[model samples]
Target chain A: MTNPTAAMLVIGDEILSGRTRDSNMHHLARELTLRGIDLRESRVVSDDHDGIVAAVRALAAAHDHVFTSGGIGPTHDDITAEAVAAAMDTPIGVRDDARGILAAHYEARGVELNAARLRMARIPDGATLIDNPVSAAPGFSLRNVHVMAGVPRIFEAMLAGLLPSIPGGRPVLSQSVRVERGEGDVAEPLADLAKAHPALSIGSYPFSENGVTGTNIVIRGAEGAEIEAALVQLSERFGA
Target chain B: MTNPTAAMLVIGDEILSGRTRDSNMHHLARELTLRGIDLRESRVVSDDHDGIVAAVRALAAAHDHVFTSGGIGPTHDDITAEAVAAAMDTPIGVRDDARGILAAHYEARGVELNAARLRMARIPDGATLIDNPVSAAPGFSLRNVHVMAGVPRIFEAMLAGLLPSIPGGRPVLSQSVRVERGEGDVAEPLADLAKAHPALSIGSYPFSENGVTGTNIVIRGAEGAEIEAALVQLSERFGA
Candidate 1:
């Protein structure tokens, strides 16, 4: 069976302005691969309402799952929730369930649930909340889109909790052989191998070390035996 | 005048598969900001032909400029040039100009310009070549889309040479004030500040440290004097 395909929508002006370097996309990609989900595409957009709404609608419609990070805080810049709701055509309001979670967490710390803070409780109708253990403000899952925090720590925690519930395909196995030769030298044989093994994904990444150009040929497939067999064949071809 | 809006299309399966983390996007964002170009959006797609074609077409039509990295190399997996050519509806072939550059470099190094290595000479019709100093392979610019190498060193070098030729707007000026309060406490006044300064872009990024939550308010504008004035007002309000 085909692995579930996913897309990531990263929302933040800070990232676009080069004030922040996003690490969540890498983390999500790695985790999704381990769970046998193919992360097909990722997009980073500034904190603009129309852009966020359009990106969400496109990504959500194209992929089986869409994971979004950022613009879901108490600040005025946090407009992701509203945009996502609009895109999904869902009415959103401060729900009691989400409010209860935030209230308990903040009240215990002697923090008041003012109007600004209360905005965190807003959830789209017919959506369920994704728990954020780092901060009390919860992210929500509106349809197939999982809205999570931009903070790396919080995004990681939320993803750990959310992944088990997601259906996954067979974990893809990978193996690589390094040839201390230019990519051009490795290209012909690698192409032949790739054509021979129609089910596997074979790729070449070139690197320069000590003034010597080399290529690392990576083979990936759902069958471990096929990967092992391909590696052996590649090693024999390159005599590495 | 509004900055020329640009989009980035990063093409590589290594990035989407989590085998490699993409750093080119951050580098491009910072450089564009300094050059007064607004990098409005970025997308990462795997080395699939159709996917690359679709992304290139979409981004090229929506933005004033589109910058693409990867998929131009001397391997079977290197399909970006063809995909980009197809997207622009232009024919592509191994041009003599690009081939001459590669032939001289390879011959100087006592390397044969074989079929695999010669693949790097392919350039799209009616395109100008972007010289590569690190490696002999040349990048190309077809219309508004600038295609460059995926390697960080090469991508950076290519960009440094290419940016000066592109028209730009005034460089955006930015200043920030750190408020030792949660985003909730800063939202109302920050929103007011944002409203008062209609020309500036005001954003808040929240952080937690030592169990204390605080928000950093960043103000950005083209006018340096206006940015300074906004900073002073923000400091007075937050006493930061």
Candidate 2:
């Protein structure tokens, strides 16, 4: 079977405005990679409905899974749920499961569940709620799209709960060889090595730190033995 | 004058495949914020030409400036330059200025300028070269779209050379107040503060650490004084 592909949509005005450094993309990327799911694309969009709708539809259509972070909150700008509903052409209302989750959360904390708090309980029709153990507001999964919280901890918790449920392929295995040579010096030989290993992906990442120039040659593929073989060949050829 | 609005397009198959974690976005976001540019959206597209063309046209039309990172290398998969030219409906050829940069670079390194290496010198008609001090291959700016190298350090160096040429408006200033309270508890007061400060953007980013629930109330605007005032009000209202 082909690898299960995924895309991430980070919805927040704060991210676009550079007011917040986005940690969601990195977290999701690492998690999906570990789970053997290929995260194909990630978009950071504002709180605008049009932007969210356009991105959600495009990414959902392209990938096996579309995970969205942010905008599922109690504030006026929190419009991701509505936008996701619109994108899927589904009707949106307060879901019973989500309401129960929120109600139980507030009851345990001895807090009143007001109208704004109810906003978090709303979900698109025909969706399964993803429990947020860190927060009362639960995320929902509709078809291929998983709408989760923007908060790092809650986002992570929700992902941990959700990723195991999906089917995954072979996890991508990678090995890195740090070379003191520049890319220009090693480009030709590396290109040949890449051609030789048709199944493996060889990338040369050049870096200069503290006046030292080097390239980190990363060889990645599905088979651990093949990746190790390629790394061995690279070390032999390059004298690292 | 209104702030110069910008958007970022990140093109790479590696990023989509979860093989590469993107650092260019954060760097560009911080740089744009420092230069007072309003970064509206960011899209990570595959190395597909059609995807690049569609995103380029749409973003360039909407924003004042469009900065793209990645896919401008000498490799066959590097198709961002051709895609940009196609999107702009402009003819692309090896420009003299870029050729000069490439020639000088190859001469210093004592490397033969092959057809693949010369491919880096090809740029669209009526485009200005953005110098890459770190690497010999220069980035180019066609109209308002600045195409830079995919590597973080090189992209950053190219942007440093390019940003100062563009005039910027008032830089966005912000202040954050960490509140050890749930978003539902602080949502009402934050909303009140947001309503009071129409010019400022008030956002609550909920986070949890070691079972402690809290939100970082970030107030952002072009005016430092206004952001400070909002911060003071938030501190008073939220008991920060």
Candidate 3:
């Protein structure tokens, strides 16, 4: 069976404006890969409501699962919830369950659950809340879209909780053969190897270190034997 | 005046497959911001030809400029040139100028310019070459889209050469005030400050360290004086 396909939508002006470097997409990509989910695409959009809505709708339609990070904080710029709800064509409002979670979290810390903070409790209709052990505000899963916090720790925690419940296919296995030669020298053989093993994904990532250019040929497949065979063939052809 | 909007299209399977952590987007974001070009959105697509074509077309149409990285290498997986050309409705072939550049560089280093190596000379019709100081193969600019190499060093070098030619508006300026308070405690007043300075972009980035949560309020604007004034108001309100 094919692995479930997923896409990520990262929403934040801080990223677009070059103030913050986004790490959630990378983390999610690695985790999804390990969980046997094929992460096909990822996007970063500024904190624009219409942009977020359009991206959400498009990604949700294209892939089996849509994961979003950022813009769910207790601030004026946190418009992701409303935009995502609008995209899903679901009405959204402050829910009692979500509010209760935030209330209890803040109450213990002597922090007032102000209106701005309460905005985090708003949830879309028919959506299930994703627990955020790192913070009080809960993320939500409406349909196949899983909305999570943009903060790295919180996003990681939420994804850990969410992925276990979803069914996954065989985990993708990968092997790499490093060649001490320019990619051009290996391109033809690599192409042939790729064509011969159609089931495996063969990628040549080139790197230059200390004025020496080399290529790392990575072969990935669901089957361990197939990946191992391809690696051996690649190693033989490149003498790596 | 509004800055010219730009979007980035990162084409590579390595990134989507979780084999590579993309630093080009962050580098491009910072460069675009410094050059006064507003980077509105960025997308990472796998090495699928159709996906690259579609993303290039969409981003090229929506923004004033579109920057692409990856899939421009001398390997079978390097399909970005053809894909971009197809998206732009242009013909592509190995051009003499690009071929000459690559041939000279390889010949001087005692490396044979084989067919696979010569593939780097493929240039789309009516596209201007962007010099690659790090390597011999050149990037191209067809219409508003600038297709560059994916390697960090090459991408940075190409961008450094390209940015000077593109006309830019006033550079966006930024100032940040760190507050040792949760975002919810400052969201309301921050919203007011953001509203007060309509031209400035106020962003609240929260961080937690040593069990203490604090927010960094970054104020960005074209005018330094405006940002300074907004920073003063923010400090007065928060006493930070």
Candidate 4:
């Protein structure tokens, strides 16, 4: 099959309250696209244990692969690992491999490995460690769920490590034409174009500029040439 | 009791395939924050009936309100309304109110109210209508699930219409200070500041530019003055 399905679970209270702009979702979406893994669903849950557990269980069962970000830190609110364990009905404890990684990191930095730091060493049972080049604490994978750190740098590094281990499908391709016209003016034509390209996905994103509206018509498909042809047609019809 | 918990369900295959960039989540996050409703979770599921049905049930049970976007269009890929009906075990049919609104819209545009267009009017039974001012294909709310159109303009207009009917809590307030320093350099002091403010939520988002790293320290709480005080303390510690 050319379509490999995946989902994302983002766990953090900061993101929920608009206290932070989530960059990880965009990064993951792009990375997964490059890997030809269709990131079918993404969920952002708070640090609440029950919420995390429920989302994990639901997403894991539905998607072929599930990637989670956030709540794996040493802070009081970080609870993804435990929640994942609870959701899977599996045991969770500090594993030797994860502990060794944390210990070596703290040792190199010459900082005392406190109880809070040791919290990062805990992993769900039957999970394999995913190395983090940017940070010492490791992410892990159990069954279909890939648990990574919430911090963007650590998350990206962990994803890099994990992507290579999974098989991917054919990459999706996209082409865009920026039209200096309002979507209201282009809606009919765009709708007609979309209908003609039954196998392709087309979207018109409108933006306002200095009281004038413009639309960016994007055509996407698994075939690059088809997207290119659509782009050419769109430009010929509506491009400035 | 004043803090309302909410979740967003984005149903579409375009998002999962990276064919579309999700703008609705960010908009909902901002709108919910202003309304004092905590948007604790967001899920993006595909056009699949099972996935949407499962996500709707899980989120509605866990949240005070669940808002779903997409899959309510006129196309075959649009299956959210049906999925929601299946999830709630309610029969799906063209709502009288919704059909009137959509028919009026088509009439105004001198377009035929075709079968495909009627597809947009088929809503779950016993749901309240949410008016879409931009397009007039009204969304509906069943229990706590508020279904809205996928198009940004239409979705936003529908949200504006629905926001007033829903009760909200005290809005979250935040203040931020950008410090041109690494996370490790500021973590300890920031942690202390966080400890001092028991009611406030403090987060450190670190970034890099031109090989120089910096952290944007955010202090958020219900009290404006408390957040301002935290910002002052943060500036005193690390401000340029």
Candidate 5:
């Protein structure tokens, strides 16, 4: 069976502006890959309404699952929840379950849930909440879209709570062979190996470090034995 | 002047499969932001022809400038140049100018320009070359789209040669205030600050380290003095 396809939308201005480097995309990519989901495409957009709304619609329609990170916090710049609702043409309100979760956590800490804090309880219609064990404000899953917080810790927590319910196929297996030569010396053999193994993908990446040039040949496929078989032929060709 | 809007397309399977973490997106994002070019969106697609072609077409049309990284090598998986040509409805061939450069470089090194090696000389019609100083395989710019190598060093070399020619606007200025408290403590004041500073963008990011919760408040805008002015109020409000 084919792996369930997935896409990610990382929304934030800080990530685009160079103030913060986004780690969630890589995290989600690794997680989804391990779960046997084919992460086909990923997009990063600013916190603007049009960009967010358009990306959500496009990715949700194209893939089986869509994961979004960032722009889901409790500040004015956090417009992900509203923009997501707009994308799905749904009405969002202060969800009772969400409010109860946040209210209980805040009351126990002797902190009042003000208007800005209460905004965290705003959930899109027909969506279920994804637990955020790190913080009280929960993320939500609207149809195929899973909207999570931008913070690394909170996003991971939400994903752990959400991944088990989603279906996946066999995980794609990969192996790499390093060769002490430039790409020019390795391209011909690598291309020939690719022709031999029609089901596998062979990638040649050249690297130069401190005046030393080398190439890394990676073999990827769904079957572990097939990738290892390809690696054997590649190792004999390059003497890696 | 408004910042020139740009989008990026990163083509590779390793990134999508999580075999390799993508650093070029962050590198390009930082560079574009510093040059006053608004990098509005970025995409990552596998080494498939249709995916690359569709992304190149869509991003090129939507933004003022488009940048793509990866799939410009000599192996079988290296198909970005052909895909890009398809996207713009242009023909691709081994151009004489590119061939001459590659021939000279290879001849000097006593290397033969075989079919596999010569494939690197293929260039889309009506495109000017972007020089790669690190390696001899040059990148190309077709209209508003700039296609460069995937390697970090080579991509940076090509970008260093290309960024000077592109027009830019006033760089966006930024400053940050870190508070040793959770986002709930800062959301209200941060929202009020965001409302007051209409021209500036205020972002709050939460972090937890060894059981200590902290929030980082960032202020960004094109005006340096206005950002500095906003920072003073934020520091006073958060007592940072």
Candidate 6:
């Protein structure tokens, strides 16, 4: 059986406007890849309420699990919670459980908990909280949709807590042979091998550095033996 | 008028699988942001044929301009050219002009141009070639969709040629104030400012480093003076 597929929804105008370079997607990808979960698709959307709601609904339907980062915070722009609620068609409110956690967190730090701060306690119906060890404001999982904070550290923390609970298939393994030849020179044999092994994902990543160009052929599949065999065939065929 | 909306399609299983960090999206986002094009959305899909075609068609139709990265090389896995053709419903073949460029490029370096190398000459009908200065295999622009190589250097080089040709609106201007307070403390004022200035995009990004947490309030809009005014108001309200 194939690994459970996942889709990531990254929300923020900062990411879209290029004000910030996103690192969370790369982090999540690596984590999921190690777990053997198939991360099939990822989308970055602006922090518009309707747009986020639609994206959540669409991705949640298409993939086995949907992980959203960003728009969950204690701010005016932090509309992810409400938008997620709208997407799931569930009522959201400041839950006593979540509020107790926040109250304790703020009390320990001597920080005042105002209406805006309480916004973090507004959890959608029937959702389980994803712990935030970095911060007290918790992320939540509503069905298959795991909503987490946008901050890289918090996102990583929440994911560490959430992933262990989800069922993951055998970790997909990969091996690569970096050919010193240009992609054009290596395309023929590479294509032939790909055709022979239909189950594996063979990727041709071209690189150009110091005025020289070459391709890195990465062979990926669930079976370690299959990947090793493909690597052997590739090395012999390319004669690299 | 608002800036022209654009979407980026990153076609690669490597990116989805977390084997390769996708740099093209960030590179494209920065370029579009500077050119005053609103990069509203970006999607990373696997190297699947039908998925690539559907993503191309969807993004091309939704945005004024669509840029696709990866899957344009000469490998068997490089199916972007054909998929793009199918998406636009145009016939694709090894064009003489494209072949001539490839042939000249190979001949100059004394490299053999074989059948696999010739695959680089395949161009969609009626599409204008996007110059790749780093390597000879040109990216193509069919209507609003611009298909470029996935490699960061090549993609940037192609963009330098392609963006100037496309119509861009006024460049977006932005200013940020780093507030030494948590996001909870800044949300109320942020929401007020966002409501007051509906035209501008005000983002509150939080950070935690060395056990200290702070928020960076960024105000973005087309007008410089407007951003200045917003920054002044934010400074006054936050008293930071």
TM-score of chain B of each: 0.97, 0.97, 0.98, 0.94, 0.97, 0.98
Q: Against the true structure, whose DockQ is highest?
A: 3
Between candidates 1 and 2, name the one with more favorable DockQ.
1
Residue range A1-240, candidate 4, lDDT tens digits: 667888899988777776666778778888888878888778888778998988899889978999999877665556789999999898999999999988899889787677767888899989999998986888889889999988888899999889999999887787777787655456667667778788787766656668765767667788887777777777677644
Per-residue accuracy of model 1 over A49-161 as CA lDDT, tens digit each: 99999999999999999999999988778999999999999999999999999999999989899988999999999888998988879999999999999999999999998
* List of clashing residue pairs for candidate 3: none
lDDT of 6 at B238: 71
lDDT by candidate, in order shown:
0.92, 0.86, 0.93, 0.82, 0.90, 0.90
- Candidate 6 Cα misplacement greater than 4 A, ranges: A209-213
Pick by TM-score: 5 or 6, better one:
6
Q: List residue ranges in candidate 5 displaced over 4 A.
A: B210-212, B235-240
lDDT accuracy of residue A9 in candidate 2: 98
Off by over 4 Å in 2: A190-200, A209-212, A223-240, B109-116, B196-198, B208-212, B223-240
Model 4: lDDT of residue B50: 92
**Candidate 3 total steric clashes:** 0
> What would the TM-score be for candidate 2 when compared with the true structure?
0.89
The list of candidate 1 runs beyond 4 A from truth reads: B210-212
lDDT of 5 by residue, A33-132 (tens): 8888999999999999998999999999999999999887778889999999999999999999999999999999888898878999999989999999
Among residues 3 or more apart in sequence or in different chains, the pairs in candidate 1 whose N, CA or C atoms overlap within 3 Å are none
Candidate 3 per-residue lDDT, tens place, A189-239, comes to 999998999898889989888877898988889889988888788778866
lDDT of 6 by residue, A31-108 (tens): 999888888899999989998999899989988999999998888778898999999999999998899999999999
How close to the true structure is residue A92 of candidate 6, measured as C-alpha lDDT? 97
* Candidate 3 docking DockQ: 0.88
Query: In candidate 6 chain B, where is summed lDDT lowest over 10 consecutive residues?
Result: B231-240
